[model samples]
Target chain A: MITAMSDASAPPVPGFVESTFSPLVHAAVHRCLGVAPPGDGARTAIVLASTVGDATTLDTGSRSLVAGQAHQPLLFMQSTANAILGRLAVDLAVTGPLLSLSTAVPDDVAGELLTTGALLLETGEADRVVLVGVELAAGDRAAAAHRALGTVPPAEDLAVALLLDRDDPVPHLPELPAHPPPAAPPDGYGTLRGLVALAARNQGTPP
Target chain B: MRREVLLTGYGVRTAFGTGAEALRDGVFDGRPAFAPVTRFDTGPYRTDAAATHGPAVPLREVLAETAAAAVRMAGLPAGARADVLVGTAGDFTALTRFWRTRGRDADAGGAAGSDGAGGAGVVETVPAWQAAALADALGVRGTRLAFTSACVASAMAVVHGCLLISSGRADTVLCAGAYLVEEENLAKFGSGFALSRDGAVRPFCADRSGLLLGDGAAAVVLESADGARRRGARPLAALTGWGVAGDAHHVARPHPEGAGLAAAAGRALRGAGLPRVGYVNAHGTATRHNDPAETRGLRAVFGPYADSVPVSSTKSTTGHLLEAAGVVELVITLLALRDGVLPPTAGFTEPDPLCDLDFVPNRPHKADLRAAMTVNAAFGGVNTALVLERT
Candidate 1:
């Protein structure tokens, strides 16, 4: 049985400008783990849940010349649902086994992510696991949707990193949404985007 | 509890050429299938290395053809029953190309429908779809799943398939791994300085620089001892044990101390009920970091036996097949066991001092082997080990 979840964030550390969303999530994980910036010794399994990963990296030339260019679909290579684990590993020099999953429904994605993190803890795979959820709403489709809604953009980038420990205490928070919700179309990135939103909302941060 | 997982049949389509028989013959004759990349213009890519058979054949057709060949090699009846397990790093490269095309044309909807015709909705072609396509071609009716853990994908798929058989979920499981070199992979790895500069792969050698990327597919038919006996199939090898671990270290780079890899190998040996192994088919990518790290890990696990037991990396011939590396290497290990010979590590001239293990060099060595181990570490810090015993 796994039950503890704590979220943390960083104020955009310098010299880590590969991607805005990833570094923010990494900083949050580092803060939650209470280790140095990279935190390789956290002994944690990382599950990267995202809706749109690295969409900002797609070039305009590629987008105009190629159809899925805006999607930066090739960026999928760097964007596993659990890609943060890879990034953290590279940063922290970790070599632990990492697992990633993606689900279309927001509620189902959160539930499954939490359940899987708990399972990993229960199975003795890791004593603590880091769950990083990030979403970047800069893609063409997302921009078009924002324009159609005629609403001011809240935030374009959101990230949340939760440090889950089997023996840690749980924090009191607002009620979480219900599970077994309606299924959404399979986006390239999954519930990771929603996780970022949940994290920002929990922090009382807009976007 | 330990269960005996037998290799009832095996199939391979590789750069050394197609069909299991051809691969076996090439292995026996020291033939390598590596060649210059011709599938696409790799002008911007750093490494020009690949294991392609031809420029005209697409990866999907290659997958279907190899899967059919594997089924034929297994000699399963027309209506045989078996679960399907596929291990892959990514979905079809063709789908990526399709996405690039469809992303350009807003009028073109997403993935093509099941009918192979274009559809209006988003085209979702995942790794499972490829597995389903292979299943449909084989007329197999069983649970199908795709394991995608980068390099260890197919190894885990084989292990999971074995678990299904042991747990009585299916009598036989078809485990296959397929991956093709794409521009994205070439560019990303090249940009990271991951590929070799000389376009040559020299595993465990002092002059070894880095890995050379290649693409290919391999499959094996796994079954319980009872199932194989019932089918009267000649067993190729017995998959005795498997161990999986995550380094929790770095994604691309391995733990400097190789602690996670050591644990995985130890667990695999323990699962196999063996105190030591005869040979180790190493995951020697020949990179500046991997060869030494893997060597240290092997020494840590096998200790005194590390120097005596023959260890070699066949990737010198096939190049690093990435996700498909495990299955291809497993097939080679099985062949080694059957032939009573160890394949040599090609291009290994000067020995790396850090890597002191007995890497059967330039020429193959004939030896009687009872059990062998294959180790693979992937990009996500996922490490896996599979132990096979002579039947």
Candidate 2:
């Protein structure tokens, strides 16, 4: 069984969120596994999942620069939902296939994240794989409500990263619910919120 | 673990006429279908030549006409249900126009009553929604996907269709690509100096400066070999292999060294299980940058055989169809493989010394082609290659 979850946000320590989140999440997961963080050169795999990949930074930059130019908004390149994977790869120093997927459907997104994370561990693509789901809030009220309800959010920014391993302690929840998990949080805040919930759940002894 | 997927049927709409007969006649008789721009006012743009239609036809109508024709040719049941995959650069040219007009109206302080009813009013009018329209028209109840990968959209649609069949997700898939001329896109290309000046397209020619824009739709019915056999369907050609690669180098220009193009070609060849190829239907946009880059990439991959393999650019006749170019050229490639005839690269006169290859020029050539490859390189450094084998 694969088990690990953590959250990171952009509000506090925006610059170091990605770099710090991986090691922090790694430490939390290692604590649960009763192992130390692997040193450099140790084989580890990472699969980044995000709806607002590199496109976020590109969008911010484009919005900043569009005021001066009379050209088409380079919005096309600014919205790829895969930049987070590249950041995670750099942070974790992972040398493995980085798969990025975007699903508008919430339930499907959660299942896909778990399934992909499981595959990476099973296939030996990575010894310990990290699955990250990141999204930016759309500044819409309906989106925020959806994020809070674990359903399709109207639009919110959140990021949640989960570490999955083959030899990890399984969570002792009431039951593995048959119903699908709600869509992952929006890009920024939702990600951090979900990660917090994951970290809290993994804080105590493994059952 | 790739499975064999076949192109059991195809449909096409072009300026020459609709259906396979018209396309075949246009290809064989050396007919050019380019005419004055009718879809929009060309005064703001400098170009005079385009594959214009008599009147602006709704995309739904255009898709239905060609799709039904292809279904009839395939002899599938009228009520047949299959997966639907649509490829296009722009989903709704008319919708975009509508939005632009709405914007103008809002700016002029027109009453908001023209916005129509309900919050879902304008949202339902998007071109992306047309995929569902086509799916509904074909009575396809299985998976439906819309791909918009610039010029490589339709080719990717074909690739995805094959994947769907091989993965057993669907027994039959309708892979279609469409593009109707939009003023903004045309003006953008014209400003970029990519549009041809002579009101004609001349690919791989020494004097070739750029490409001429055209609008049309092409679709293919893909099915698993076992499924086709079970249905007693005769396949026109087999979709042997396909490869998609991103340049990650530039947004508009291809990799200066043709790295991504070569990689995509290698992947397609590997997928097809063929080390050498018989013919190549090149992207050959006729632009100074595209032609030479493609020629160099071909040489890098095919080596000595590159000089001998009869390569042609159908864009010379059809003009650059943007997203629809891949499917249109693909249909032509399938026709070539089936008929054992290599279509000519229409506009070649004096060959460029840099592009040293045997580009079957002026007229079609008869040959015993076992396999043919089609290449498409998009503006965003997205490159795709497809291999088709004679059935």
Candidate 3:
């Protein structure tokens, strides 16, 4: 059961440069926490899912290195994808488990990041799991990667967060919003984006 | 809620060689394998040395070969579909070479390669792409996940494998980690002033300066006890327990006290229903921050027992495999259990008072080690602990 849900559609994060990906992820997670206060940081798990994670940063870092430009440690840091998850762990005081999942196809059963969160609860790994699914508009490298893997890149930068636990019954599958590029889709598109477009598509709906 | 997970087989490749013997000779033999980095020009870096892999092959190729080997070793019947989960930097080396050429082809997908589409044949590399391709190569039918969570990623992959087996989600899982030292990694460490000035990795030593990167790839086949019995596979050891925790302390640095690492080890021991482990395979990056913090972390959990536990860091010889360090170190620990000898902290010169735990310094300690705990801490304040026991 998703106790709280939120989505951030590529909002401009002030002073957050490098790529809009981190900010989008942070925004959705921030909104979800605001609505539903955290119970125990140590008992919570944070899982992030992305097929092509922060491709923008990867492309930029590659071009900079190839072009002989000064190497920015921040770009190198952000390129790992888990770096932000770590920062979030520190910020939210989440010590349970921080996992980042990357799969070629988002439709696979194991690729479902939300189900993983639920599994954590079912398996007694966490009291609650903050599941985040994010994808930024593909850069050249990511476009080629998507073309090769036969995966469709998201229309634009999009992120959705769901806070779920074991006690909640089946969640309400509200009508998911359609992707409108930077426009917050109402609900979800299914597992196509992996947080698989689970019901709460509102930009920032408090449960 | 718990089911037994057995370690059926393992595959490892390092500077030493490709088999269990290689790991024994290269890692457990207390030999330093650090050599000059040939993949990239190391003129701009602090030190020009690391435990580098000499192969010019593609990253996915290495993973595919390694995965196939593990499956064969596990004695899985032909066409046995198993999940492939690996912690890696993907094909960064090939990507860097592509960037060096700055060349493009009209057939973009073809350029990337039919499998990885970019393991040096093309310029694009995705962190998760190789794991999917490896799963396809092995014809495995289970889930594929790529963990890029810095140093602890592979250990976390192992922990996840345990959960999957215990939760009945997977029967046979191929859990592995591989990191080929490339320019980008060296440059990152160089700029941060974190590289070993003398090109020697000396974890827990008073004279220990810093860490050197290494080229390592290792795979462990985890099967549920029932699954292994069904296949008649020999269980080498059992992955009894595992745990993960975040420091929530800092992103770029370790908690001065190793708060997250201690918590993870404690959780793993508690879950394993054990009071103490006979041996400890430490993360021991040998950095100023990590050694003492890791010491405190161990002491925090085991209390006075830490002083008696024979602890060592194979990173002292393997260099740091970054994301691959956890699983590779795990492979070393499994070997130590198999051989009944603890791998030493190879480059130890003198003991640091802060890291006073018995480091098994400079020499392998032969003992009747029953169970060993391997702990790894990553840059993002994430930590993982795995309990492995002789079966």
DockQ of each: 0.16, 0.08, 0.51
Q: Per-residue alpha-carbon lDDT of model 2 for A1-207, expressed as tens digits?
A: 333443333333222222332333333333333344553212454444332223233323232322222223333222222223233333444434344443322334344456545544553434666555544443222232233323443133444455566687322222222333445423323323333344446655332
Error of 2 at A165 (Å): 12
Chain B vs. true chain B: TM-score per candidate: 0.91, 0.93, 0.94
So what's the TM-score on candidate 3? 0.91
For residue A121, model 2's alpha carbon misses the true position, in angstroms, by: 13
User: Pick by lDDT: which candidate is best?
Assistant: 3
Best by TM-score: 3
lDDT of 3: 0.77
Whole-model lDDT, model 1: 0.63
lDDT of 1 by residue, B1-391 (tens): 3347889777787776776566666554555556678877766666677666655355446666766777777788876788777775434344345435445454565443222221111112244445556777788887555555667778877766766666555688898887777665665566567788886778888888788776678888888888888878888889887776666665456766666678788878987889788889999988888888889888898987878988888877777787688888898888888888888887778988988889988678888999999999876567778899998
lDDT of each: 0.63, 0.61, 0.77
When sorted by TM-score, best at the front, the candidate numbers are: 3, 1, 2
Residue range B253-330, candidate 3, lDDT tens digits = 888888999999999999889988999999998888999999999989898787789999998888998878888888
Task: Give one digit per residue, the lDDT tens place, for model 2 in B1-391.
Answer: 4568888888898777787677677764455667888766677665878875567766667777777777877778866768776765333344344345544555677743433221112322223345557877887676544555567767867766766676665689888888776564565566567888888788878898788777778888998888889999998988888775555555456666666678678778988888767889999888888887888888887866777888888877777887687888888888888888888888578988778888888888888989999999875466778899988
Report the candidate with higher DockQ, 1 versus 3: 3
Instruction: Give the clash total for candidate 3.
Output: 10
Error of 2 at A169 (Å): 17
User: Against the hidden reference, what TM-scores do the models get?
Assistant: 0.74, 0.72, 0.91
